[model samples]
Target: MAATRLWIAAAHDPAHRNGGWAFVRAGAGGETLGRAGGDRRTTRARMALAGLLAALEDLPPGEALAVVAPRPDALVLHTLLKPPAEPPAADADLRAALAKALGATTPATRTWTLAVGDPAGPTPAAFAAAWADLASDKAKAGGAFVHSIPRPNLAKVQGL
Candidate 1:
């Protein structure tokens, strides 16, 4: 069975509401999905609350809630490698690079820049570590958010 976890992956810009809350059913072996994008008229609170419910509905039959989207306790990972450059010459190459360096399909933080990328250059080690760290943080945020509110309340809570 996959180890479930959750997290809210936000962009560096506060104005951009393109971020989403991630939910991993089980470590590297499980599925990774999330509720992304928000409209100006809708507050993140509502999106999150609704997203939580939507995500829950996908849980496998007879499965117990093992993790929430907003929580204090979560896994922690260090930067291990730099992410592949943006607009990689070839998509296959990018996948191969990430697979070789991080050994994971998806990164906790989407995109190379957010996960691990610098104009100067990001090492493979740094990228890998950053992704690992984000994985734990995202799961905790989702877990904690759910813990505080069993159901979607449309109540905006900080740090989620």
Candidate 2:
């Protein structure tokens, strides 16, 4: 059997040292086979990048991983081999990071969509909707399966 594709929606707030992530396994008709999220103890950019890279590396081969972050710098650094030495300005937006991460000519076969959302408010339904749409689109375009790895909730973080 072929490896499955994973769609990851992450809500990160560097200031609060907390974040939430949801993983979905994509299937025909944009169905989610599995889902999960939780808090990241270390909200530091480097830690976040390391955690994400570790998670992605642990996944089974052929499993395409897509991660969505409120800020794009984290995601860009995760994918680029020779990323800039300095960190992006704290205010940088997701679109800019995505554009930098995915330069021209790179086919977005198994990709991640970075959906920005408020870390202080209730989880945005729009983010979830975007994940669903992307997962469905990818499944249709690549004919690959998708699944979400289990994670923890950020809302439970103390003093959030």
Candidate 3:
């Protein structure tokens, strides 16, 4: 069975403490899908876990997967790689959900890497981070409907 590679990331806006989470999944054949969401007021750790949970929820039954994330999100990696003896006091629900997901998943690899290599060009992590940032902004805006206005360049854009 081919293994799917997943990259999960979270972004937090310190100004309002709003946060978002995103996951990018790439199949063996290189097809990719991404999903992102936000919480009005939350910690980065919570958002990271949420992203992992979201990704796991979307996993196909019995499919093998390998997870990758930045080192800064060690809490998330630790939770998945080596769970604590007891349930965490904070974000217990998310932790429990993650545990459940891990229990059911068939992880292809347990190796953890810190870096995402190049930051110059857009990588999966970068894309996930951008999605997370956008989601955070949307949450700060009270989940209002958003419409896009395209422009040929910086100026001459239509709609406000």
Clashes of 1: 30
Residue 10, candidate 3: alpha-carbon lDDT: 78
User: lDDT for model 1, on a 0 to 1 scale?
Assistant: 0.31
Off by over 4 Å in 3: 85-87, 104-120, 143-160
Tens digits of lDDT, candidate 1, 81-108: 2433452233343234433333245443
CA-lDDT, candidates in order: 0.31, 0.39, 0.65
After TM-score superposition, what is the CA distance of residue 97 in candidate 1 from its true location, in Å? 41
By lDDT, the candidates rank as: 3, 2, 1
What TM-score does candidate 3 get on C-alpha atoms? Answer: 0.73
Alpha-carbon TM-score of each model against the true structure: 0.30, 0.34, 0.73
Sort order, TM-score high to low: 3, 2, 1
- Tens-digit lDDT track of model 3 for 1-160: 6678877777788889888877677677765666778887788888888887787786655566666676656555575576568746888888767766766344543233333322224566665666667878887887522222122221221110
The residue-level lDDT of candidate 1 at 151 comes to: 22
Cα RMSD of all models vs. native, in order, equals 17.0, 13.2, 7.1
Q: 9 in model 1: Cα distance from truth in Å?
A: 5.9
User: After superposition, which runs of candidate 1 have C-alpha atoms over 4 Å from their true positions?
Assistant: 1-3, 8-22, 27-29, 68-160
